[model samples]
Target: MRITNVAFAPGHAAFYFDDQAAIKAGAKQDGFMYRGQPDTLGFEAVRQGGEAVTILLQLENGLWAQGDCAAVQYSGAAGRDPLFTAEKFIPLLEQSLKPVLMGLDVATFRPNAMRFDQLDIAGAPLHTAVRYGVSQALLDASALASRRQKYEVICDEWGLPVNAHPLELFGQSGDDRYNAVDKMIMRGVAALPHGLINNIPQKLGRTGGKLSEYVTWLAQRIITQRSDVDYEPKLHIDVYGTIGNIFDNDVVKMADYLCDLEKRATPFELYIEGPGDAGSKDGQITLLGNLCVALKAKGSRVKIVADEWCNTLTDVVDFVDARCCDMVQIKTPDLGSIHNTVDAVLYCKKNGVEAYQGGTCNETDISARACLHAAFAARPDRVLVKPGMGFDEGMTIVANEMSRIMTTLKAKEAAHVDQPLQTV
Candidate 1:
């Protein structure tokens, strides 16, 4: 099927006040409160008077593809909040995507190689968030045209589970940071009930007192909260180069903290995300090796997960080949297509490494549905699906469209599977 039309819908909305308050209160009880506005950190608070951007693509024969891009607010020291403001990336979508994608047969697009040359040409200066938005649209369109769930298309083609959670945490507060953590947990529980929640904690530097203490405290909280659940929530912490300066010593301390948490009868699994600037390739490998040794010595089951350092499937393959980590986190935009993202997951599987899908903070329902399809299809070890939760008339419409797509695809799949072969 061909892409018939591409549309951009950009707008704003208010956050869910009650949800934000519940999150803030939970965090305060755990000693984490807003360093900025009282309820600003929760979805309801930040969405108040802010814009939410959505992009939709329609295919030939009236099929639909859509997603959202929204900015989330956070409280932290200056330059450290992990909010994703979509303005920097929307222009790429607003520009003529039709020229780049129209008339091209969706069946012939090589999802894996499409981004390789582009990424190489762009080098490290790539606009990750923008690339992610554009790629998500393409995946949605491709899935709709192919008559497959985005996740199924991704998994069957790429070899990984499409249902992994991509947890994002920003800031460096001690137990006092519990509000953000609580909100994240609640949201994960609410939005992605069937998926894994990969917790990516912001880093603590060499002078780590409260930061380290907080990591330990939060680990305990997760363990305690999940004790009764059938499957303990999956967690991954992002050090973001904050631990690079101290390396082994910090890893050891982190391991100790994790061991203590596990000792509390909390069976949750934990993974460590590599630092962003440590030359993610070599740095992540070395760090994972060191972490593995330390965890082995302490008998901890914590695994190492590659994130920022693993921008491509090749990078992930290299890391796996080197025995650097246990899991490879697939950042879809960085890979540039649903197919390639699936390929990355498959590459990880080939090497016996678990794969998890990561989400861009600026994703909309169209993108989330694409992600959901990818997750469902691949059935990855974990996934993170985030759609800006706001009250927008357009947002509601986008969601309805997504549900329709899912229903249509499932019906078509069932029909094909049940059909008897025609006599030649």
Candidate 2:
């Protein structure tokens, strides 16, 4: 099938975009908003409502494939793309990309996706968010044209085994660390509260006592609230480099603190994401590499996850090859094309590094669903809840999509198994 028309609509994402640099540089919280000016360019305030554009491709056979162009919450930080406002990008899509989409064949996906992903405008590629959404639409179109699922298309193209089973879901708590943890526990998420520990004073504490107490509380709370006695969820928290900042970026001191936190989270595994940001990709790798060695030397089980400065497929490869961290957050939106997310996950798993198929809360349901398909095909170690910070909303969207896909795949397999043999 071929794409007959291209249409788009400006829309809002499930969450807000926050200037990560501004927040890390001491932007005070002002009741769900930051009380300071934005440190990043293209941002008017420290926090603003996130926006997206829903791109719909009308196929010649009268089918519609949809995708949402959205960016991460911490836009314009850690070598990421600038903020993605629907109005700012809609014209580019219309003038530059819509014509290209109209003439393309939807019988395949990879080459079409790469065409848009690598399209150069004025000697530069399109914005990551634009490429991201465009690729999703192409993947969806390919699936619809072939009468197959998105995950099936990915697996078929990449020559990977189709993983019809559900992946482990990791939940993020935003700022509602305590209450959100309860919800995640009750829901039986394999990975518990992300615990946005970005700040040193408020969340991580001056001497790191506060985070220790919080981890202790989290462990106890899980034991108290879990209906299943054996539901031992791994405690994964994103510190955003607060531990490194508080400890003066000293690898030894950070290792000591991480060991302590691991003790507090006894009988449960702990993963700390972005433990430190060295402000540059090489610097981050060096710092995390040293910290990893230190943790191993100390016999600490706390796993470090690379986030900042690790934005692209190349970055994922570099970080994994360097052996800097135990797991890599293949942040889907930052990687631009959905295929990159898939490739990154497969790469991580192929190597010794674990892949966390992660995206942003400042996404939409469309992007989240696309991400889920990629995750299913790639078979990442765990997939994150996206499009929102609310524990329930993101969880429901991801869980339902996973359930539907698995149900359909199982039925299809059963039907194939029960079919009669042909006269071959």
Candidate 3:
């Protein structure tokens, strides 16, 4: 089916955008707002309300398919696209993208996604957020035209088998690390508490003592409150490079710390994301590659994940090829088109690197659901529970959607199995 029309609705994303540069530069938090001038060009303050634009595509079948255009929480850093506010992008979407979307056939997903993903306006490609949301709309339209689930559309086009089971879900705790983590354990999250250890003074501690203590507490909490003896969840923490900072990027020191942290985790796998930022892609690869080699040499079981400086599909490939990280987080929005997310995940799997299909808290329900469909089909190692920082809300959205889709697919499979053979 073809897209009959396209419409745009400016709206709020589930979380706020933060000026990463300013925050790293020690912006003080005053309540929810950061009390400092913005360091990022598009940001008016250190932190501001995040915005999203809903792309609604009217299908020829008289149904509407929608997706939310959203940027990462820490935009304008790490070679990513600038902050995405609905007001700044609505006119461009109308003038440049609406016409393209209006007459496109949505019978398939990849070509349409690539068309918009690579579309140039004023000598530059459309913003990542635009491509992200628009591609999602096209995917939904394709699935609708085929009268199949979104995951089915992905599997069919990409030659991947639909996962009979749900991908592992990783939950984030935002700033409410302690309370929210308790909620995650109770809910049986496969990955627990992405402790947002962005701050050195408050969260990570000057010498990294704070984080070590937190890890010990996390392991103890899980042991005490777990539903069963086998309820061991991976302890994945994103430090935003603070660990690298405290140790002065000393690979040996970092390896020792990680090895010790693994012991503290005690029987659970540990993944540390963004251990260090080297300010540029090559530097980042070198830093992380050395750290990975160091950890492996020491026989450390802790896995290092690449996040910063790994924004696009090319970046993910570069990190994997360089053997810089054990896992590469395919941050969905940063990759622009959802097609890239699929490719990155598959590439990581092929290269013997784990893929974390991660997106930001600054997304909407539409984008989060679209991501889940991709995750189910691509079979990433783990997928982030997202669109908000609240542990419970995101958990509910991700878990319930997974359950609904899994049940539907399983019932269909059972029916086909029980059907009698017929002669043509």
For model 3, where is the 10-residue window of minimal lDDT?
415-424
What is the C-alpha local distance difference test score of candidate 3? 0.91
Q: Taking the tens digit of each residue's C-alpha lDDT, what string does model 2 give over 1-424?
A: 8889999999999999998888888999988988978889999999999999989999988999999999999999999999999878888888888888886898989988877888998688999999899899999999999888898898889987766567999999999999999889888999989999988889999999999999999999998888989999999999999999998899999999999999999889999999998999999999999999999999998999999999999999999999999999999999999989988998998998999999999999999988998888888999998769997899888888999888877777768854421211
Predicted structure 1: lDDT? 0.49
After superposing candidate 3, which stretches have Cα over 4 Å from the reference?
417-424
Which ten-residue region of model 2 has the weakest summed lDDT? Answer: 415-424
Question: Candidate 2: global Cα-lDDT?
Answer: 0.91
Tens-digit lDDT track of model 3 for 139-198: 999988888889888888888766677679999999999999889988898998999999
lDDT of each: 0.49, 0.91, 0.91
Tens-digit lDDT track of model 1 for 1-424: 7777767666542331122323323322222222233443424332234444555667786876655444322221112122334454456555534355555455423452265225532234224333445566666666678765555555445544333233222111222246544544543331112111112232253444434465566656654554345534555555544444444436676566546534442344555565323443676677666766777898787676776556666776787788767877776655544556666766776678888776444344555566556555554566653443321322343334445655665565568775422211
- Model 3 TM-score on a 0 to 1 scale: 0.97
Q: Report the lDDT of model 2 for residue 74.
A: 93
